[model samples]
Target: MASFHHCIKSGKKGTAANHAAYIARQGKYGQREDLISTGHGNMPAWASDNPALFWKAGDKHERANGAVYREHEIALPAELTHEQRKELVDDLIPAMVGDKPYQYAVHAPRSALEGKTNAHLHVMFSDRMHDGIERSPEQMFSRYNAKHPERGGCRKDSGGKNRLALRDEVIQTRKTCAELQNAALEKAGQTARVDHRTLKEQGIDRTPERHLGPVRIQAMSEDEKASVVEARRDHLHRRAM
Candidate 1:
């Protein structure tokens, strides 16, 4: 499961809007590489101010252990003019899920990624809202937690216990984008239309609150490779789906 969170920047917008900005970045970029100039917020202005502080402020909220001691952000979409997209994302995420429901950060592609101009945002939030009632996000996370997520939706009616709702929410957003894009194309009288389902299948167009489990090792011998790969995929799918 991919994570989604409310990104924030104090003073620019209200708290909730500030918090959810990053997801919009990734949403625009979809799948690509090297989106962030620094690990922090994609501020070219801040880059000159202080390189060290930028990463610290934008340090990887997740991935504190394993191989990465320091946080690194992945690609965000370039389709957004940075300023325009950040504002759009910040407002939308909080407006949808409410702020502080989860941890958030913007992810841009690392330089190693190829042909990627997109800088996307990634977030990890509870499926619960701060609205004092179980929300759609809670319900979606609940389903995943029921089978996985380690603890089963925090084991409380305080939040939802279903997973489909959250997945659908992300999927729907992609759909909305597709529809808008299609309309724009039609307005221009162009034959091109976006195949929106691709995002659903690829999982980028959707938001995932839970952590995707482990991946299997590669480079095994042919005799062992097939079984190992199959097992790995099955395990991940069981948890992720």
Candidate 2:
């Protein structure tokens, strides 16, 4: 079934390096490195080809308590081909990220639920917009200098957004992701469609199912996994009615 799942997360300093390695399927996450397709854009000159270097620098140089990255985890429809999925993400990058430095990867792993293909995209980016400035790695993450722009760090666009604005941005991100997925499905002549609305918003009475993270699913015993599958089956049966 087509699914509409999109979530955003922010990480404090020192997280970007670990996350970049994980998304790139490096280190402990290297088991399925062959199944990963990664790309990066808007990088500064020093780390143009190697985004890991930029992330490592952020971990080392970004201010304490500063958010180093914002990540978007989006589930892609399994009906789309690998190329089609990449194209969908390609379209999203320019719209959402603009001049921000970003790294993204697409992974297709066997679904824990039904052993079918489960494809998804992970995009990690700095909210700091890339200005055409030349600064050392240390200065790049330093406090913004209002008086001398050349001496300051890049500006974080989301820094001053109020709570309502942040909430609206999240809503828009979810809506955009759903629209893109639906468009891709339609282009492929697929009948299955996904909605971004919650069950209550869609006038459905059933409670929404909780999402099990990959790490959590990996840790479950066979019996626990079976219980989850049974619960999912029950949930689907109820949703069908």
lDDT of all predictions: 0.36, 0.83
| Model 1 CA deviation exceeding 4 Å by range | 1-76, 110-116, 131-170, 176-195, 199-241
lDDT of 2 by residue, 1-241 (tens): 6667787898899899999988889888898734558899999999898999889889898899999999988888877888888888887776667788999988888887566778888889988777789878888888888789798888788877899998898888788878888888889888767778888887878767778877888898988988977876675455545
Q: What is the Cα-based lDDT of residue 148 in candidate 1?
A: 51
Q: After superposition, how far is residue 151 of candidate 1 from its true place, in Å?
A: 20
Task: Give the range of the ten consecutive residues with the poorest summed lDDT in model 1.
Answer: 65-74
Residue-level error in angstroms, candidate 2, position 124: 0.4
